[model samples]
Target: MRCAVANTTVMVRKYERMSGRQSWSEEEMAKAVAAVVSGKMGYKLAARTYHIPRSTLQRRASKVRYQQPDDPKPLMGHYRRVFTESQEKDLVGYIKSMEKFFMGVSRRDIRELAFQYAEDNNLNHPFDVNTRMAGEDWVRNFLKRNPELLHKSEKDYELEPVNFDQFYHFMCQSS
Candidate 1:
């Protein structure tokens, strides 16, 4: 089978030669196992041919293969959040509502809100001891985590109802 070798494609029997900590694709691993199972190539030869780790290939070849795991592993290892996901979702809703009313939330307002959320929830957060507000880093990371919470100023076109009424009246009289 043809396999990629660096920038060029090379004609290989079953596996291509690989080095370092390069990750093998699922298809490549399956192909290597297929070669060994069909008695066309031995374990060591298939491993060498496919550029896969000998131990990894041996383990797969020895075991009765099953379907892949259905669940996805968590990206965050030990990192715990100050606020729960539900709380964050609520915060998002609140921010959206405020924006709907043409009220722009500032960074400080977000930090204060986060502090309040944690306090209201009785959560033991790693926030400041004296300031009682969420740290800058926390706010920055929160923005990163919740991309939909994009901070936008109230557009100039969106005037207050009173101002809009006055403008409408002025335009009607002039025209």
Candidate 2:
């Protein structure tokens, strides 16, 4: 019983130390995998040498000799999201196009768009019918999902290329 308690205490202390700490980086993990792959050391020894988790070493090693599929796991886009994957992409594009035109879209604009988009597409979601708008939670989730739209500097954004010749022709026609 005393030995069990001591082991538990040690585990608790280890957890406390490991919490919110980056003990090993990607380079170190790669080197550890390399050492194991080249028969220089076993997983247990490599993990100890690199200070990385043994399970992490195993996972990386398994992926090293195999090609991982390009299948991207969706981030909460399937369940509980206001828009489907393609729909969200369209909305993101709309938001980005507005940014390109130097027009700022507000939170209210997103909510209204959500309501309008659903109505137009006949999408059945539990949005507020009385206000003719989407729920605040939906809007918040939308922002979180599309983080690139949040706090992105205007200068960092690439505006659509302008055609000067067409503009000059239009201006000449008007004069």
Candidate 3:
């Protein structure tokens, strides 16, 4: 009997901390900036002590010293929202109003609505023009950020077909 083995090649990218994960915690970054700002420690020394990048430490320190941050501790990757606060609020309100009318909007409708709103208002958005809809990931995150909109059940989204089926059944039974 004979056995054979196959070899496969894997691709890897060069690291400039390319893993996309932050090595230091929010508290550590804050302290590093604070130490550098207060003249307690130099940027290089503070970064080394805090196990953070020197350039990041300097940039954060400059921002902290010069400007007011909207959020105290933002996401590590600096994930920014596509829509402004008011726009998101308007979307939530629209969804609520539609639900009150017994016409709950589906996920796809919300995405298309977002695309249309962004286009109509001439606002910059990252949604794909060809698809004419926001990505599913965006809708998922949007719902996640708005806790009140979440269903009482654990399901994050409602199936429109299933809902219609239930409604149809009720109507048929009444007739």
lDDT of all predictions: 0.67, 0.69, 0.72
Where does candidate 3 have its weakest 10-residue lDDT segment?
160-169
Candidate 1 weakest ten by summed lDDT = 156-165
Better of 1 and 2 by lDDT: 2
lDDT of 3 by residue, 26-80 (tens): 9999989989889999998998999998888889999878754432234468565
What CA RMSD would candidate 3 show? 14.2
Against the true structure, what is each candidate's TM-score? 0.42, 0.41, 0.45
Question: What would the TM-score be for candidate 3 when compared with the true structure?
Answer: 0.45
Model 3 stretches astray by more than 4 angstroms: 1-78, 152-175
Q: Highest lDDT, which number? A: 3
Q: lDDT value for candidate 3?
A: 0.72
Ranking by lDDT: 3, 2, 1
> What are the per-residue Cα lDDT tens digits for candidate 2 across 66-174?
5235322335556554467777887777666555654455666567667867776687678989988888888888888899778754344334333323432343355
TM-score of 2: 0.41
Model 1, C-alpha of 165: deviation from truth (Å): 30
- Candidates 1 and 3, the one with greater TM-score: 3
- Among residues 3 or more apart in sequence or in different chains, the pairs in candidate 2 whose N, CA or C atoms overlap within 3 Å are none
lDDT of 3 at 38: 90
Candidate 2 or 3, higher TM-score? 3
Per-residue lDDT of model 1, residues 1-175, tens digit only = 9897688777777986575575777787888998876788998898888888888887887653442233222347875667656768767765565456544556665676677667766877888868878999988888888888765543422343223224323433553
